[model samples]
Target: MLRRSFLKVGLAGLAAPGLILRAQATEQPRPGSPFIVTYFDLPGIKGSRDVTDAGDGTLWVCGQRNGTLGRFDPRTSQIKVISLGEGAAPHGVVRGPDGAAWVTEGGQNAIARIDDKSHAVRLFPLPAGRERANLNTPVFDKKGILWFSGQNGIIGRLDPNSGKMEVFDAPRGAGPYGMTRTPSGEIWFASLAGNYIARVDAETAAFTVVDPPTEGQGARRVWSDSKNRIWVSEWNSGQVSSYDTESGSWKGWKLPGDKPRTYSVYVDDADKVWLTDFAANAILRFDPLTEGFHSFPSDRAGANVRQMDGRSGEAWGGESGTNRLVRIQTVKPA
Candidate 1:
């Protein structure tokens, strides 16, 4: 595999005489291993918090600082910015079945959908008398239903066609965070405050919450693997866990750093798991087949990478604190 390393130097330091940023050596790819890293510096995208692939070669990114939306095309390397209105406080994003991009506006207690072609925006408010929406992560099921987690201990669903809405109560103070749908159409979610992984049956509307194997550890994000197992990131415990849907069993791996604050968890097409260490400013990759681990740090400190999505041997995420979009391209084994 051909491996390369690149560094982003600050303008102030680079303009001072002959000073140059040191080139950190890239990690060597082992035999039968495939992965590489490519970093893109997104200007004016401070607080890039979450990203979703539009499935048409476009990437939609959300901002934490000002609730802005950005569109990027890998082919053209062009980025366009769209304001999500003042105080939108956008978080997780997903492409709805209606072909619009749906986002959780944590600041506004509502869900908004953006037309993919026109960029027209429409807002859907939470049910009357419901607590502040604190709407966070969102995902769409096969039937065109959009589901999202609210910080105020509830899961919400919206039918884009009819604008009908439903809310399911979670345990008090659960703080439901990221969510994903399984092949069976069940919605799996992580609870940052409740410390569990939950599943909601699409047909029956029943809910199940599974305690993490590590007691007292809060799950910040969740993703379903190809094998039908759900993976979760233990934010405070610095660990990753897997729950077997068939056997109702659980297993976990402790991250390298203590109290690492693992913010996001994703499994690529090859079944390898990837995690973001917010405090550590690094991306960690774990190979389930080999049980081996690899770590890559960001070019800049205080990056605070929050969420990610993977596609075509590449992974993209937003740096919430720095307001930048980070990209990593994996170099396949030779």
Candidate 2:
């Protein structure tokens, strides 16, 4: 259904922002819009910070507070919870190339790997003498090395085959939160406190810092499109920004409406940028091809989706505050 909205343009004084405001999803999906959203209500998990596909028709999630790993099957819409043993405040979970859910355990300052099929858990603790790493997210590069971020200002990599580990100090020394590997195999990370995105050389372990135009933009998360541009969710500035690696240029747009704090960002298979807006309790989609915006408000208030990712035209995320996992499918009818 096509719906009309009186948007108050905040940036240009057209009506309302440092950003342009988009219309809310006042009605269900239009006959032509390419999305069919679905939700799986996962009970009994708190602070489901990050999620990833299990590669076997399931999604793996990290229960940050409950100190457990969660698996949600879209087919059955049922949730299976696995304890990470004692001191397991896991923050990030991703399915590694080895076919296991690799997690950044914040409480124990370690990385835990859970077998996707066996549901077995194994912990890989960080080297000692480092203060709590405040582990956040993990990513696997093309070379089969596992990289992870720590909000407490550290980045590291683990070789699953040799069981070898290496840690590096972030240049800014705090807030290395969310990360992604580009199509070029280089790793890029967003430092929420540092206000910039840094590119890491996977082989050499060197960093080249790239700053956004906005001061204190609070780059919370990062993702890459098919073109290899880096997309970032700006928490403090309430914007979504991207850096084109080829051009070395930057572009950004503020979230729709006033004071829309973006908590997470993801680029789907179609390269449409998606973000979670805490202010509206909605998921926002930006069509780069048209330079237009669309909002998908949740059925309930306070979805508070922290991290999101998608593959195979299916996007999945957790309602950190609501104890649920939701999926959005982009359907183009035949």
Candidate 3:
């Protein structure tokens, strides 16, 4: 495994010449000793992009290619699917405030909420008269209102209580992808095309951009630690960067391998950063305490585990390439 370290990046690429931190290191991929991986077959539900807790032992997933939302009980290996109607290419699924699965439906050009049991579907179209939005992922703010991203250069908020939905254009367009709320309750999202992550002011719907250290390092996904610092996965540069919100500093490390393609990032309860390397076809773990990278390669080939979320005990992932939901139980090394 190869590693690179850089810190104290200036905002908007404005700094003394050659002041940017640049160094590289290597790490060996972790073998199958301390990790126990189990997979649940999501039969017939292919192209899963994201997963979220169903508020039960089960998990809800987006069947991106099949135009459906699926609920899978990992304990029993039972899966239930609900058709979001034709042309409903759902991209992200998260449990909503009402204890239901909310979907960003790009195919239907709307936001959808589905009952956990009855699976009844309700569509909330992007503010009236607007063209179809290339919807991406969603995250809820402290007030229970939903904030979402659209790859078509847009962001929006939905008030479930009042059925009021509004859309706003991102500062830089056409790449608003993954989104996560900070511990301080601020919502931030990544701009894949724009190469920056921006924080959203929920009340005003304002976006403030945070640039990554490396130019053209596609900011594909963003997650926050318990301390409210933002962690972002840079797709183009194959690195993970952290923004210390309080100090206004940045630190970044590249994923191991010659051509690591970082697709998703999640920070678990233990403060360990989890990432999916598409090029290596494995889930990589980064321990902040040790500043080391560990790899947990999936047993099945091409287990493209995109978009994961952490819970109290474990982290869940949707293996889109294999059409399965995987739960990883890691034994901490002594």
Candidate 4:
């Protein structure tokens, strides 16, 4: 395992002078747009990927390419980077109830816990024979147990208190990519290769697969809205769809422009749907009430933001290609 170290960086003292300002210079949203966009260049984090609210006005970001995790404070324009371990390519991160950052540590094939206060790193490797499970995402159930997915046909759970872990085969052979917890306490995951979304029984670990309306839509990620509806980003179909878990109905909307490749989907605190489109190089916000889409294209080409999470007024994502963290502050429409 690799040794862990913390590097505190302030934008003012960065060796690459004016790098953050240069990134922000081109980030202005279109004129009259109700959103203000800002970009922060991550000093040492390469592949700044999946991000989640760290609960204390900061965010936890996965440094996939560089094998690290970063705690970013927006107000101070500072970040604290913590190394995971040798070959530790973490994919997804979420702030757990314990105020720690729980990571799907793909490189180590283990679950990692980063203490919020101490910046301590702890690993819980999977049971034998589950090597290279390709861990992707993790979500916590109502009972505080952690559930996670693997691209290599595995669904798993961990009891943080007991230090016990369990892994189960997914319904389809592979492609469990993103997982989310609904307000109703149900867990749902999207299968990128299997092209379906499924619900996991928190108690039994049984999976009930749900097919999207479009075949081969390639459901890459899912987020639950306030109504408990599952919003999916279809990579193959280039559409954003929502499933009404209660009504058993579905709705799909194709993204604007040609060859749109929807990579991630997030439902904001106000129930607004946020999506990242590869083709347009933009972050889109979909208003359910008006059925309209607003685009916030990145000024730079290939801004490929992978995942997003946020608080009440802001949506945050990592610009994996650019190695920057982006924040879009939403101003409510009168």
Candidate 5:
């Protein structure tokens, strides 16, 4: 397993004005090869955070501002908004086995399910008094049980069939954020406030937490590769890291540029990691095998692309600040 590592290079050690000038000259976005930008204006989407492909060409987008979920049809370019009641504040969206799209409503502290065909919405309340149930990412397991990490440091399982809920506590204020399951059926999640990656065995309900190598750089999101390694993004540190399940070792790569705040990370079918630089207003592609990095800026500065989904050779992302959906198609090398 080749783990990519990117370290901050140049200028930090320099004390002279001439060295500072030379570093600035080399740090500009590449010149003249135009990066195409096609924006789809999503009305009433003031705080779009996550976008998930429904595996059928349509996309499910969640809004953090209004607790609304919008469905976008790529082929027809039509948009449909489903209200999850007042103050739902949907943050993450994914397709479930029931053929409906499931969303985590952060504001109202609940999970919601929306029918793809009928556009009907059903809300599932969290266990009472669990305020941390807000800001969850729901993942369906192999046995069809829906697992979610609550923002306030709790993990819960919701039985979609019976609507029964079971909850477990994480470290106090861990702020469990993005999550993914391994091929072996263990769930791994980022502990944003706790600054670690926590794992839970599906069968035994046992939990373990791995502290990140860099302090003050809490884990924000996670994704799994085909080889079963878990990759996590350190939002505050501008670095990405990988954890090997087989070897039980961790490795990391720092991002390019100063203060690059990565919000979401995804591994495409080709196994390359794609990151959205929220602070720098750019999208970065990292080849894990080569440790090669390529970056392209969003059309507008501070576009704040929060989440992305890769499908069919294209990457689709939600731009929160711009109130639009962005598509990035791969350009084959000549």
Candidate 6:
């Protein structure tokens, strides 16, 4: 029996209620700060999480609660929501090289792809007995292969062109979460329950586990810097640590709050580290040079920005708990 898939394209150019204009005044900038923070309310897309640049001017955000993927236009404050099918609770989305939104659709136990132009939906079910992989995040490698992690101890890869996929049981069962591709073309992932990060061998589909210095650090998410260093969000330790792949050395810094709950980490073009702390209800910008952190607390309480991805000047995150999307624009220093 074959699985069924469906697509529902929303009326375009329709502005959701309470949509904040891009030019509107945002949270007041901190003293000598170069970041302007703004939030846009996504009324219908409940539990907006994991966002990626659509390659055009818009962004692709997953509606984890609503089973939809949204294309948000910042300039017009308009969104076109595409349903991923019934019982589709998507955890992460990434814009594939083919210009479609590829999702880790956990609820339906499949990988979904939503075309950028036609909004066509496609589903690729996992092989037999791989049910409930608990798909978490997806990333495209330099070779255009889509790699994803599952909290249920699985790492999988898909060849977009061939529609072929391979899944492997991750070492230390039950916690592969966020994943990223390094500048050097290596794919790495964080194992939250396993308390470590691992580099994926693209060819053999094998994992090379690299342990963090802190035991039980809960390495939840990972992002690769331009230099190929793996920056990890230590959920259990409330610390942001980076492993220098070249030197094989690690450095970590604790978050600001007395009890921070670090959730996500993203490395921008300038190498600035962006992190979210659920305890502080804030997004943090870390400067590796100064070794300091600048906090940007959300205007609304409990704004849980789960995952972040962006372009050159803008950093975007989905405020999952608040049902909103947030963007922080940074001005480059002269």
lDDT of 5 at 81: 66
Name the better of 3 and 4 by TM-score.
4
Model 5 lDDT tens row, 1-334 = 1111221111111211110000001122334543344567777566777898876778888867866777777667666766667656788888998888988777767677777776677767665566646666888888998888887778877788777777777765657888897777778889888888888777655678888779978788898887788888898888988999888898889888888787788887778888887777888888999998788687776778877776757777887887778876665224
Model 6 clash tally? 0
Winner on TM-score between 1 and 2 is 2
Model 2 per-residue lDDT tens digits across residues 12-45: 1121111111211222454766777765555556
Per-model TM-score on C-alpha atoms: 0.87, 0.88, 0.88, 0.91, 0.86, 0.91
> Candidate 3: worst 10 consecutive residues by lDDT?
12-21
Report the lDDT tens digits of candidate 1 across residue range 1-334: 1111121111111111211112112332344545556555555455788898887988888866766777777666566666666566888888877667888877767777777877766777776666586788999888888889987788877777777777778764657998988766778999899998888887656678789889878898999888888999988888888999889999888877756778899888878898998767888888877777798778778878788887867777776766666666784535
- As for candidate 4, its clashing pairs are 2-86
Query: Over the stretch 111-153, how does candidate 4's per-residue lDDT look in tens digits?
Result: 8888888777888887777789999999999999999999998
RMSD of each: 11.0, 13.6, 13.3, 6.6, 13.6, 5.0
Give the Cα error of residue 315 in candidate 2, in Å: 1.5
lDDT of each: 0.75, 0.80, 0.80, 0.87, 0.74, 0.86
Q: Find the number of clashing residue pairs for candidate 4.
A: 1
Which segments of candidate 3 are over 4 A away from where they belong? Answer: 1-32, 331-334
**Shift of residue 292 alpha carbon in model 2, Å:** 1.1
Model 5 scores what on Cα lDDT?
A: 0.74
Instruction: Enumerate clash totals for all models, in the order shown.
Output: 10, 6, 3, 1, 2, 0
